[model samples]
Target: MQEHSHLDVGDADPPPGTARPGGRTARNREAVLDAALGLLAEHGYAATCVQDIATRSGVAASTIYRRWGNRDGVILDLAGTLVAEPVGALPDTGDLERDLTLLGRVILDVMSNPRDGVVQSTLVAAGVHSPTARRTLAQIINRRVEDTKIIAERAVERGDVPADTDAGKVINTLAAPIYHRWYILGEEPTDDELAGFARVAAHAARDALLT
Candidate 1:
């Protein structure tokens, strides 16, 4: 029988190199992170605990606490979960409207998927009090924003958008509603709704409304 015991994770920082340990240590780390992500997707943030992760991973609860310190460290350490990609990137379609619509669809897919949703939700949950979580999430968003710069630059070059239009602003505007509905309102929007928002952002950009 699995223990439904709540977490006993410490608030201290985990040991250095916890994710890169050697031999069986590495194996335990891998097992623990995998279990954490699976459980988080299945049960959500409030329902999951270190005991649950340990039971699922076949690792000891105490060992998990020692290695990760808390749920924050565990979720934030999950493999490739938070790895960022170039945001706002669409194939060169020679049309800003089409590119942004595609970008919005991509964001919608990520937020709507069960596994990906949980990974992001878990990060947001952990970011509340965890510096590591906050930093990691910020870094991922920053990278995405940086990557999207090319899209804005191209739009400027084509004169489809205002000169020196801010890429970060455009992507953020498009993403704001989707994220709000998902995380704040606890609702998943329809594909049409997601695409609509992206389309609106693109329209706004071309009309210089986002300026």
Candidate 2:
């Protein structure tokens, strides 16, 4: 898979409050992330540890620690990597409703993937107690927010939404309920239902409520 341009943070310990960065004393970043995901898949997040990932990836325990700070950080990074589509990558169909429906599809892709859902929910539940994980998750979210805002900006240009529409709120309004149903209600919505969500969000945007 192609790495995102935003992730090329060189081989340094990424600054806190930044996007996912490559880090290591050697070429072990991918190895470590792969091992972490495999172990997470097999044993779940709570049961997996940094040492297990170190052993599985054949990187040193100290290196993993210095690179990611903890197991939660590793899990968060993996979650970011697994997003099927970056918010910015969602296609612009020249219509707000259609664009948002496509956004719903992206959300559906993540919600339907067991691995992706587990990793996301795990971080949401566990990152609160870990500074590193929390910070990394924030960086991930900030990146997505920046990406999604572009959609709203385009909508504004087309007069589909008001110029002052808050893109973050618009996206949150569009995405929150779908994710709520997934993580909170333990429900998997059909494509039609997902499209409904997009329609609702589109209506709200057109009505200037999400501004």
Off by over 4 Å in 2: 1-9, 14-24, 62-69, 76-88, 112-118, 128-132
**lDDT (Cα atoms) of all candidates against the true structure:** 0.70, 0.71
* Overall local distance difference test of candidate 2: 0.71
TM-score of each: 0.76, 0.76
lDDT of 1 by residue, 38-110 (tens): 7876778888899999998899999888877887668777624446333434546877767766776777676
> Can you write out model 2's per-residue Cα lDDT over 1-211, one digit (the tens) per residue?
2121222213444456644444343347767777776676577777899999999888999978986788876776676564433543676889888887788777677655555555666776676787766666566666666677777779999987888888887777778888788867888877788788888888888888976
User: How many Å off is the CA of 198 in candidate 1?
Assistant: 2.3
Candidate 1: misplaced stretches above 4 Å? 1-22, 79-81, 84-91, 126-135, 209-211
Worst 10 residues of 2 by lDDT: 1-10
- Every model's Cα RMSD, please? 6.2, 5.3
User: For residue 203, what is the lDDT in candidate 2?
Assistant: 88
